[model samples]
Target: MSFSPTGQAQVLVWAPEAEQVELILNEGNTSVPLKKEEFGYWSVTTDLVSPGDAYKFRLNDDQEFPDPVSLFQPNGVHGASQAYDETSFNWEDDNWQCPLLEDFVLYELHTGTFTPEGTFAGIEQKLDHLLELGVTAIEIMPVAQFPGDRNWGYDGVFPFAVQDSYGGPEGLQRMVSACHQKGMAVVLDIVYNHLGPEGNYLGAYGPYFTNKYNTPWGPAINFDDAWCDGVRRYFSENLLMWFRDFHVDAVRLDAVHAIKDFSPVHILREMKQQVNQLMETTGRTHYMIVELDLNDTCFINPLEEQGYGMDAQWVDEFHHALRVTMTGDQTGYYSDFTGISDLGKAYKDAYVYDGQFSPHRQKSFGVKAEGNPGKQFIVFTQNHDQVGNRMLGERLTELVSYEMQKLAAGAVILSPFLPMLWMGEEYAEPNRFQYFVSHTDPELAEAVRQGRKAEFGMFHAQGEAPDPMAEETFLQSKLQWDLLPLEPHQTLFRYYQTLLKLRKELPALKHLDRQNLEVVENDAHKTLQLRRWHDEEQVLCLMNFSNAPQTVALPLNAKTWNLVLDSAAPEWKGPQPSAPTANAGTEVLMQPESLLVFRGQS
Candidate 1:
């Protein structure tokens, strides 16, 4: 089962349906016969295939196709898989260690549109910028191979291979190396819930999928059925490969709620246990974070609590509450969150629907996370799904005023939880993060377009759905790198950088325990305030969601209070207030669509 380290060729192909299978090298220039086993898996071994050598699978009657689990396909999705030498690349991050979860200032970006070049190498050049902006980690959207060169990466079929268009496997390794050198950890967003519609050859190979459960995409993966042990191992091995081979520090599991596993030990727990063992063996503190819409804390709880034991989980409640409070848009899911009370609850409890009614789901769900530390929750104002799934891909910057945008930023960064920022959110880039996919099948493409449009019909009735297949939509989604150098963008970027710096430097803000946090709400005035105090250091944060200025007395007593940050400063083009009055002890004025942070002297 093991090949020599000097670059030998060994392949394991599970093709029970195929009558015959052979290795076709370089478009049928040569062929190597494979040995079939009782389990219906074919095995091949030869020194003929070396790194960069193109090859394919030849089934019965010379029907040749790419390897189902190809490690590298330099030529493209339809091309032959090249022999990939994972150990050839010289890595210089032997001493690199990732920052702790509490120290993470995460920046989420899509690889296909994060820069002008939209390649792995292109992103390497911007690592210094992120490092300078105080980002401790970069969470890249899925890089697994999809149907075409351009995609958002979520519709990936080849979970083990990097996208050939985005510089392939070698390009990705280089990007990770460069990031480690800059003291920034890399978190890869991986989709295990479902594979893309096109090039999904796993079903042809084995029972990689099942009809026992249905996901939004289609039939769910067979993680608990017969031969499902190997299926789960496939994904677990993929996670290990990323951390050991590519030096990725963490993995962000996309849409975990869709992973319907009925096994005694769930796939999430198995993956977590394997990752923990890997971390121990490698002496690296890697993380496994999940994106779940379930609003459940079990994923982030300890294994002793009969939970999945994830390091952190994304809290959609935080984003939903902030979105409704800032924009006041009550269509779709926003209908469940209309008042400032929801925002206040999200700020204090980190889950607005803690066993409460959810009009969108037509069910009462979620459990209260009272004693859990805030570091276990990853809070964001905007993320890929929140923006890209919209009809026009309008980000928070497009709907909320500049002051509210800053307030949103402060609300997340200064809170007791870890914060994540979507790409271009710091500078309020005007570009939209629209959904894009590249499907080879004509019928599949048309179906996708129709389904997308139909889904948005209830929310937005006008205009045709932006073609997910169009090259222009993909190009338009790329980050406008030039905007960072412009006026207002530059100013806002500086503000975000300052906020990150403050979060790192200030002891009061760095405290992430939920027990140390307290919140007060004035729904009538559309105002919410959160007070985080620990060890004699106190921070009072106030946010005004109304369209007009309002004044509210501070809920805490302090001898001296200094104005720290104001979202309504002239820099953000909002009303500026005079210097904070001295000895304001229990009274402070708040501006419309603004956020204020005050540090109190004990």
Candidate 2:
């Protein structure tokens, strides 16, 4: 909806199924009939509705519902939609240039749990903390308006409206502007797979869903079926709205595998083309990162190469292999990973299961991402799913020792791939990041509780899963910022800061070229030696996942390897006081469950 200078607004609705459409303004105090146009669209130029006016659409004299393209749901999902002027907010980030994808050190966070306030403004208050941690980008979880204030955001029913509880549209603009001023990029997570069950009135408008494919949630979106053109336009406009109106640097599409689109011109490819056009038109940098379960390179590959042209993708294989090697937990997907050797493959070839027969799926999975650069893959030890989906939502800090936690940090940060840190992972916060929701429907809430129980059947969790509908569950998942200045947590925070600093200062680590990388895994000793070079600057990352000290022979070279950072050093509160350097043909003693970084020049 766009308002004219004379307070007249132009309203448009796409309701192919409705015989009559009425614009109900201010709780039906004023109503204006819409004229039907071709292609199942209804439009009207009305003076009754203006900016900030609460409105709803009445279909064929039926029950009134919030706008399908509502910009603001002030009273929640089941309430009236408020008119919001996207051009009203004064942006202060005219000169903000987003960092290159290769340089992005992402910090994934949930808006409601990152702070006590649980709003976008609350996030703005912590910009200095993130800056001190050396995070280049902040990937916020879904902020689309869900049923209630406590959801993890996957249950969002209004795709266009910003969460009213999270300070609404203006609040997000403030957060983005603040981040840009601090030289940080923002990546917003979006869901195009399925909308939340409650308050979902799209079915009354048109065939927005189809039975062609079934997603884990429910019926897939109608992206390739009849009347898919309108459905496609709705989402494509949403993709551009983030960059154009909200000033978001990028969007992390949640579960692209679940988006069932079989069109000849794939929806993903169309999105990429539109993004490119927007970037060209606005002269601003933008990217589209996808969360993909399938380890397919077609999504990240270039358009010229018959690919979806996505900027990057999250690689769960790296996290799976790393977790298996460190924790030795062979439960669901971890059974497919073989330990440090698979992690070695992840370091060399982004995908560990490249056309290999999987015991999990009982079939060959994943194709080789051979020529793809290391920057194309995003690697992390813990994410929202890896942590929150657990029955108890145990973070790495809860399951592993202090040394192992540091080792995990080193494993991700010291690798060539883009590194992302989950909220509170830096300080090793003890609170569990469990799943929670606040659905109004009692039956729906009960269904969620039972669903969580069924989902955890694969893993042998000792006790019953926490009640996802409980308010305490959401409160318990929040990050404890007070722990930052406390013991062990502060040390770990410094350790991560130092590692990020080294990554920026060292050429061998800063350059993300994987072609010059060589990874050697010793399965018997449970160790990995990674050697990568940029020009004359060479670096070696030695990891020991075993529980016993191992004396590993160093490769004979012309240059001496000097100790850079050691997880087992006394400074990091480890068993060892310091790390030993290795010369040509010499040996170094690696502490149990520790990682060491060394720099050398020839």
Candidate 3:
């Protein structure tokens, strides 16, 4: 239950199976009986319950459970729920405004492992570094209340509550305020597909789950079942809470494909409508971005097109295609990608396998995004899922050479779609973002440890999986900030900074016209030619992913061009690559595993 501003609180719970229910407050010592209302709801209006008070609900005068819609479980999910005043924080973001989606250079990070402190305050301290890197916004991993501490946050149980270990509600408010103060927006990752297995008491309070559909996290939420109105109300309220209360600019909905709802107006559409209405009422910038495996553009398409009208969505296919091309490790789902063509297709057409058969799933995956804008797709080389899900959690830096890293960065930063950088990826962090969790249950912990070890067999990785329960496991995953000033690392950092600067200052690079972008792939020479234009200014990007040097003729818009950023330049500690000799006709010589960007004004 949520507490209000006038020092009074109303507690309401849906407990149809309980014979009697009571509200336990003031440290679970005082019990107050609640009156049962229609629709199987038990409620109580209490003046004694004030903010900072700890309470829980007693079912049948025997069992107790923390509030299902708790604002802050300061003592974890299993502990007593605390009454937190959402409007208590004195916000300082009155003049703050978010940049457009196309202008965002997103930096994604996990709170706990981002710094040694592993709290929201810790993240606030690192905002200066992001500002220096030319980042437009920060997209943080999930911060909802989960069991113990070290979860990756996909296993969040209480979607409304901030993780207590990460400094609770006030801490989160401080972080958001800090971001706005620095002219950077904050995007929060939230899960709606399923709640964590542990501390999930919504089913006990109401028909919050349906057994008709099964999900990886267990039974799907009752979005289209009996007593589903309350189910929908619960999530819609949670989505607005982050925007209205926490002041997060955007909400990144995780794994929308797993959310099963056969309703005429889908839950996603309903959420978009509510968020748009909120934007109309409150003159603040708010947007919704979802991560879905289905390559449907309806999520981000216009409402007149019978779409949900979302702002943007994550593109995993782009990352997969790029990874296969750069790393040449085509195991598992990466097997479906024939790097040369697939990478070019995803880069030019947004989706490589749109409505095409996938040999891996044995079914057609994704629909075409032909009409969607390029800015609606957010692309990244590495993320928490792609890296942490690994048994050893080895980042791309550990698997690939330094030149390929720069090539990938150029591809992401210079592309029309929004670019995102994982934590410490700019400086080539040496630490592995290993998967770690601190479940109090020994059986679950052991099972996770074994499962992680077995999953790496396909990758043929060496070594035993680190124990998730160990404190060292979490500590080992923390970013090494000292490595930023070291050799090769500092050069890459400068390269990323310069690329972002060019992206912001150059019109051709910033243009979001999906139709104007062109790609030329030559399997014979293992090279790619990208032509992007805005008005009369044009950018020619030549990429060489192969180990051998290659030369390609440029279909130049102008005979004269300026080399803006070359990945193989001596400044980046490469092989001191040189521009192609003018005597060799119009062909430009490229270094091995490097990308060269040229700008021309016609």
Q: Give one digit per residue, the lDDT tens place, for model 2 in 1-602.
A: 76766777888898987899999986688889999998889999987777898999999998899999998999988999999888789999999999999999999999999999999999999999999999999999999999989989999888889999999999999999999999999999999999889888788889999999999889999999999998998899999999999999999999999999889999999999999999999999999999998999999999999999999999999999999999888888899998999999999999998898999999999999998998889999999999998889999998999999998998999899999999999999899999999999999999998999897776554888899999999999999999899899899999999999988899989999999888999999999999888998888888999999987767654368888998999999999843577685678889999988888856
TM-score, per-candidate, Cα-based = 0.96, 0.98, 0.97
Residue 290 local lDDT, model 3: 94
User: What is the lDDT, from 0 to 100, of the residue 109 in candidate 1?
Assistant: 92
> Which lDDT value does model 3 have at 45?
81
lDDT of 3 by residue, 410-499 (tens): 888888799999999999998999888888778877887787777666655477778888889999999998888998889889999999
Count of backbone collisions in candidate 3: 0
Model 1 alpha-carbon drift over 4 Å, by segment:
1-3, 16-20, 37-40, 59-62, 459-462, 571-573, 578-581, 584-586
* Top candidate, metric lDDT: 2
Name model 3 segments beyond 4 Å from true. 457-461, 580-585
User: What's the alpha carbon RMSD for model 2?
Assistant: 1.2
Question: Of the candidates numbered 2 and 3, which has the greater lDDT value?
Answer: 2
Which sequence of candidate numbers ranks them by TM-score, best first?
2, 3, 1
Quote the positional error of residue 399 for candidate 1 in Å.
0.8
How many Å off is the CA of 34 in candidate 1? 2.9
Q: What RMSD, rounded to one decimal, does every model reach?
A: 1.9, 1.2, 1.7
Order of quality (lDDT): 2, 3, 1
